[model samples]
Target chain A: MKLQRVLQYAKTLLSESIDAGDIAIDATAGNGHDTLFLTELVGEKGHVYAFDIQQQAIESTENRLKENGVSHLATVILDGHEHISQHVQQQIGGAIFNLGYLPGANHHVVTKSNTTIEAIEQLLQLLKIGGIIVLVIYHGHEGGKEERDELLKFVSSLPQKYVHVLRYEFLNQKNDPPFIVALEKVKNFPKE
Target chain B: MKLQRVLQYAKTLLSESIDAGDIAIDATAGNGHDTLFLTELVGEKGHVYAFDIQQQAIESTENRLKENGVSHLATVILDGHEHISQHVQQQIGGAIFNLGYLPGANHHVVTKSNTTIEAIEQLLQLLKIGGIIVLVIYHGHEGGKEERDELLKFVSSLPQKYVHVLRYEFLNQKNDPPFIVALEKVKNFPKE
Candidate 1:
């Protein structure tokens, strides 16, 4: 598989064979690739809540979904990190975040580690048992490395009983295009 | 989580709930990271059948495992693609192939699509229901694009009912370091 195919493999690992009515979340809906994938995986009966800080991103994703005849299954939000918890009401089966700027757009207004960390904290809480959150970190630009490093630290500290965290990257790569950091909530995550 | 942590994630996805007595296969035991992970996941009662075409690879993996005190739980073989079925007698819980050649070693002697495709077919027959096969394909070098493209085409053509296939890659990256392709044999895979 090439670079794009790896994300799909991660999605499959996070997918469950349960009924299609289960909810899913897209923490970042850049160009709607993941949002579209999740919508298909969850089927017509399912619901998808997508978030993006950029209006351009939201509009592009919305157009993509509508053009593909899947807009009914998705709800795109044009808000930053803090709005996700209040916007998405359902206990989701899985959530995904592509943590970088929208491809082919302004790279300067990219994701910050603080907001991403906050958004992830809320997303994890919203996940159900056996649910997963996939965070794809891209550290090629100026602020990228800090976000990647901080996110790794945060995920590494999550308790083992409640979650299993995994990071995927190629050490040989020079500029650090991006890598995958996935969190799977154990089926029996301990209750407080 | 660094690069090794990604392998840890792969390990959890493939063998999270498997007991201590399950059989597993490390198709490309390069440097033995996945081999050792498989050994630990399977426990002492279980067994891991690891394969590598290169004598240097098998020897290096064996040494790594022995140093880690896990050689007893795994059986390292100095055979290529076609020998997996002969080496593993029991139904496998999971099989993993880090499909590119040995890293930091000669890039000339890498995995070819022909042998890999054949091996995948055989392993599919050997896998138990609900079993998984993960292929981490690196398409960064010469001849990589052809192999990767062929493998993707092969996996994508699989029927929907029996086996669910997933391809994961970072869409935003160049050089396309490597990505993941996974196949899960459903419980009700066609028996006829």
Candidate 2:
């Protein structure tokens, strides 16, 4: 299978639950690929809240959405995903996070562990039952390792009564091929 | 998604490569679930080499296959999979291993890391190009953790040029849910 197989698999998983008019989030709108995918999945009535700290990334995503004529379905935000709770009040149907620095942008400005964990926490609270959060982890660059390690730790600690977290990664690949970490909120999740 | 979603996902991945009338193996025929699955996938012309250390498992698998009217396509062996190379000399298209003791059987008799790893090594040699090995790891019982740890280490060390190892595991699950580790041989594998 190709390296892109995991992404395809992620889309399949999301498509199983998400339908037209559902609300989705692009936790990291790098290059707008995921944002565009979400827009198409959510259709016209649905809304997508996309977050990116880089202005260039937000602009690029906005342009890509406009090009695809799906801009109406998305709200592009030039802010950290850690602040997701402040912007999104609707129950989320699904969310996607492509973790790492924006490609072709300043590599120094990266997604940190604290913010990622916080964003995930907020997303979990706002997630509808059976909703999923997909994380594509790219940990080959500087600071990437730390983010991956911390995220895995945090994800592993999530209570099972609420959600199921899945980690899909290639074990034998070199240069740290990107992996996917997904969380699907359980049906009839117990109240904490 | 249900708890069996990962298993279904594993079947999907295997179906991508395996075709009718192809040789396959069930390294651990626990209750004949995978054995039956492989038998159907391989069809009437293809053969399936099924191994289980427990006679009960072999008998169960044999009975299940007979009930399904596909017993002719399978050879049930009441032996460990570590000796798979000795019985089967032909190249294998795909293999499945449900690690841990057979459910409802004697839970003490478990698939240890040493023999499990040995079977995997042999299978790697026998796997045809584009063939896959699907491992459903049940690492919650006694000796399960060690096997999981050692197997992860072993799989992580496999050369990327030869095979791609994919791990699918849930992070937030009580009682340690089973995970899948798959290895797909590369089409243009380098000659060792």
Candidate 3:
């Protein structure tokens, strides 16, 4: 299978644990793909807070959600995801981030390491036990390599007592196929 | 979400693709855990060819199989998995390799890089299209680091047109948590 299909399969597998009425987050709501997916997974009673620094992304995501008839279930935020904690007051069941520039747009506007890391840290604080965070990393484009390297280092440095990190990457793909780094919050830390 | 439990989850997820009456292989039948899993997955009509370098592993695997009442479905081979091509004459649907010294045995006797790579290459040739190979790499023991490095280099060099390789590893863990490198033969390569 291609890396894209494999990532899709993984997202579906990870989302299986989530149920209706749960709160989810789309940290990088580019084009609303993951936001739509989270909306469906959380169902009508649930809520999704989608964030994007670019106004284009927020508009696109909102339009997509409206078209899907789930606009009421999502709150689109036009700001950097680093402020996730300030915006979201409730515990989140899951979060999804697609790193890199939005497709079909200027490649120069991409997710940076500092803000992304800050967003992850805030999300980690807000994540409930057994919750998961999936980051799909694209690193072939300009400025993407640095972000990928920094993010890998950051995630690798996280304490294992609180969260478990898993990286799923294709080894033989050319131009660096996007990879997934999934973190699941531990239910019982230090004891394990 | 310990590495062990995560590996178990991966095994269950990968096994969902296999069907009854399919031919499978246990490249390293250490303690027969995966061998038994494969036997049950293949059912009575199918067959599993399990291999091990140590007599203790073969005996333990045999005992485990007998106790599980699936002994008749598996052919336990008392040899290194490097000879898989010689023993397995038919097309295989899936293969599992546990790369490390068998538990409860002398830790010095570990899987070598040369033979493991040879077996993997042979299995790739013998594997039918859409077949999968799962390698659970344990590299925390003596002489294991070099083997892991060599294996990763080898797998990373494989051509992408014929097969796709995925490396699943925990980023934050002590003693280098064993990771999974799964290879699946492309059903429609080049076209994609």
Candidate 4:
């Protein structure tokens, strides 16, 4: 198909923003897929921060990274992504958030809009100019719709002069499929 | 920006489907920019069909194609796009529609939802497998919103087994910014 699927398109944006030796983040490390992908994109010289609130997610991500021999390149944190600002101090090339519950895990433990927004706010401050923060939103489960709607509202209100918000989705699919919302920082916000 | 803007994304999809020696169509023609582009996409050995209801649009498109030294590559027709099947019978590699009133033209004389859907229906039938139809939707003017809504409803209902309907838009911008809805035919439909 000429149109890229949601997962492929998410990587495309992240790959475009990140180069070898650049810093990246997997906001919700889930099954360690994106974290591992980030390690490959940034290479050994670079660093990745994988955050997950659940111990199972963190352990799985760490094992996957170590099995690939890139464990040292990423710091797996067992904490909510809302505490990202506390963990990451340096500028980042790109970040990705798979905003839903972990697959095969508890369905109720999904990412909420408030903490997601807080994490996004901190990421925006940490993102260098031209860097992107991609959100792959899955809204099929209970409470998913509310998170998606609230996040859309917040992102839509972001000033165009400082940010560019892109919404890419497939409209004709059956199940409520996940879509991508990418935020690119064009200019620095006034020091607050 | 890593995320392609509306116009560029439309061209990207069209270019992907069209080859040097294939047929293409500019469903709206408008100011002739996309018509001229279609001519270039299909080289000297190929053909393009440009349709518009306004005489001024046909004239401008003709002039533009002539100035570009490719007027012979296209057949400029002064008629509504709903009558597309009557003018062309060959399978098309790709097509594009700039839906709504022609830019810089009278806003009152806008393209309606029914006729636009008719044109789309005909285009889908004529599109070869893997061919695409791109619609750059501008819905700020009078009657624009209605057309946009109706078009979305129609496109969203297209069977995913044979077609992939992609909606690409930037949501942070103020002025009702234009967005893209690209339909790619992945498989042939059963004969009716």
Candidate 5:
């Protein structure tokens, strides 16, 4: 059997963690690819919150969802995902974050470490037990290494009692291939 | 769905790579658990070679295979895995190495970097196209950290054109939980 690539494994994780009628989130909503994926996973009974900071991304995701006739299942929000706790208050079964910039768009507006960590913290709080948060980290561009390093440091510090943080990476590849950092909630919220 | 632990993922990978009549190897047949597992995976039609440096390990594995009534399908060897090139000269479908000391045995007798890397090189040579070699690295014991570091370095430097080196690790766990390093042979051989 062929080993799944980064994106394929990411989708596999989401598919395994999410079921029909379960709430999901596309934290990046880049090109609307993952948003559309989440919509199908949650189905009509479930709902998806698609977040993006750029108007272009929001428009792209909205158009993709509309074209797929799945607009009703997902909310395309033109806001940073760090504010997800504001838009989505209920527990979610799964979420995905594609770090770095929107493909074929401005590379300057990449996902930074601080906001990304904040979004992760909020999502972890809102995640159901046994739920997963999949981060497809793309760190091939300028200032990308810093973000990747910071994100790795932050995730490594997460307490193991409540969550299991897994890092899936290809070591021999060139061109800084994207890697996956998946966090599975093993318990409820962290104890105060 | 709950994420698979290290051992489960290792078996899943082996099962996916090995066919019913394929040749397989247990590079470190510690207590023979993985050896027995591989025997089932390869089935009665296939063959397995299990190797260990310790006499006790070899005896235990031999007994387990005998008790399980599959002793005829596997050959137990009381030799270091670094000598794989001498005993096995055929292309293999898959192999597994459980690094570190044997469980419930002397923790000081752990696998080291030089011999581990040598065995990996030999296995890669003997692995058929699309075959895989899975390494379950347990690095919490004394002298284990150095071996882990060296092994990671060696695997990372493998040419991407011929091999795909993947590191599957858990970041948040307090203890150094065993992680998986899976190498898939994508090409016949690396160019000199």
Candidate 6:
């Protein structure tokens, strides 16, 4: 399937009945495929908080949204992992991250596992009960294997009652450029 | 993940948003995991038509349902792919097939691609609008590669307006047993 198709499918999977007028996030707004999807799903009344570490990525996403006539529905922030919680205030409906470097630019500045996992932790807190988080991991580049492995390990450790995790990829394919990792937060999180 | 967990997740996916009085099918009754799931989902006044070529599979499934106290709700038929249309009369709410062999049984008596494709054709006709058909394909065995590749090709060939196909797998894991393949029949399927 095409990359945009994957993003579209992710949006459908992550959406719940409660998301009719709720907030959503795009943790990695690479090329704006996911950003556009989130904006459309939330409609004019709902809000989208999108983040991209690279200025070029942000600018490209901004341009794409403007061309698609959905820029007003989303807040595109050019910030790293630390600013997400501050930007996203309301309980979130869903969040999606396409984790890798930009397709045609900055091939070397890929996402690191440490910061990605940290971002995941922060985003998980932002999600409400039955809310979902989707991560598309591209483990075909430098440090890709380590990141993929670490993310799997972390997700596997999630307690059975609090969260549900799913991984989707084409096993018959050769090199794994990217695969979909999804987590849904349950309502009754136990007191820590 | 354990096979039981996978089965549970599959059951959840198949039952979500479905009503208690809707009809459903288990195209493969391997160990009756899905057959039993459908039996419970449809509840009283509803019916399930479970099909498998192997008599042993049928016996095991019947035994499982009896063990679970749901035998009254299901009909386990020891029949081949061509018998689906004959058994499932009305449009169904959902159908599922755990394609591959019965776990820990004779792996030689596997579901073939041609028969599966034919069964799918019948199911599309037998499905109601907004109904679902889920196929769990294990592409790690001897005939698995062909089945997986061909099934993907067939599902991909469907018109976008008629059906929505989703492929879910883990790209990181080596020799992953199976992944989910789900198809949702659009409301506007052309009248037969």
**Candidate number achieving the greatest lDDT relative to the actual structure:** 4
DockQ of each: 0.04, 0.61, 0.58, 0.90, 0.76, 0.13
Tell me candidate 4's fraction of native contacts, as a decimal between 0 and 1: 0.91
Candidate that would win on TM-score: 4
The candidate scoring highest on DockQ is 4
Candidate 2 per-residue lDDT, tens place, A79-174, comes to 899999999988888998888889999999888999999999999888888888888899988989999999999999987777888888888877
Q: Write the per-residue lDDT of candidate 5 for residues B112-151, one digit (tens) a residue.
A: 8999999999999999899999999999989889999999
Name the docking class for model 5. Answer: medium
- Candidate 4 lDDT score relative to the true structure: 0.94
Query: Which ranges of candidate 5 are over 4 A from the true structure?
Result: A190-192, B190-192
The residue ranges of model 1 lying beyond 4 angstroms of the native Cα positions read A1-192, B1-8, B188-192
lDDT string, candidate 1, B81-177, tens digits:
6678777767788889887779878999899998898888888887777777888888888899999989888877766456667544433233555
DockQ of 1: 0.04
Off by over 4 Å in 4: none
Among incorrect, acceptable, medium and high, the docking class of model 2 is medium
lDDT by residue for model 3 over B128-150, one digit each (tens)? 78778888899999888999999
Q: Which ten residues in a row have the lowest lDDT in candidate 1 chain A?
A: A1-10
The number of residue pairs in model 6 that clash at the backbone is: 2
Error of 5 at A192 (Å): 4.8
Q: Which regions in candidate 6 have their CA more than 4 angstroms from the true location?
A: A1-95, A98-192, B1-6
Q: Candidate 3's error at A131, in angstroms? A: 1.2
TM-score of each: 0.53, 0.90, 0.92, 0.99, 0.97, 0.62
**Per-residue lDDT tens digits of candidate 5, residues A55-125?**
99999999999999988999989989999999999989999999999988998999999999999999999
Which digits, one per residue and each the tens of the lDDT, describe model 4 over residues B62-156? Answer: 99988999989999999999999999999999999998887677777788999999999999999999999999899998888989999999999
Query: Which 10 successive residues of model 4 chain B have the least lDDT summed?
Result: B100-109
Fnat for model 2 comes to 0.76
Say which docking band candidate 1 falls in: incorrect
Candidate 1: deviation at residue B146, Å?
0.6
Error of model 5, residue A75, in angstroms: 0.9
